[model samples]
Target: MALTSHLETLKKKHRDMSEAIDVAQRAPGIDGLRLADMKKQKLRLKEEINRLSN
Candidate 1:
């Protein structure tokens, strides 16, 4: 049950990060490094979710 809850939270965070990246891309003068970092974090979350799922 706890693992399921953790997975849900990670999924929510991944979704939010994707939205944030989209908004940041639209905004002016977004930091390139920060955006890259956010994408990396999102990828890590996805990997973890996949690992836990199996």
Candidate 2:
């Protein structure tokens, strides 16, 4: 796959994860640890997208 495609995919993944986290945060009895993990994953995806774009 092309670099641009990879970047787009990463961005989409990050957005999807963010939305998921938001939903999870709003739900009752949500796990804080899982939300933290999702945030970490989002950060890592963003870093990867930045690296690939450069």
For each candidate, the alpha-carbon lDDT, in order, equals: 0.96, 0.91
lDDT of 1 by residue, 1-54 (tens): 999999999999999999999999998999999999999999999999999999
Q: Report the Cα lDDT for candidate 2.
A: 0.91
TM-score per candidate: 0.95, 0.90
Q: Which 10-residue window of candidate 1 scores lowest in summed lDDT?
A: 18-27
Please name the candidate that would achieve the greatest TM-score relative to the true structure.
1
Candidate whose lDDT is highest:
1
**Candidate 2 worst ten-residue window by lDDT:** 1-10
> What TM-score number comes out for model 2?
0.90
| Residue pairs in clash, model 2 | none
Q: Which segments of candidate 2 are over 4 A away from where they belong?
A: none
- Report residue 1 deviation for candidate 1 (angstroms): 0.6
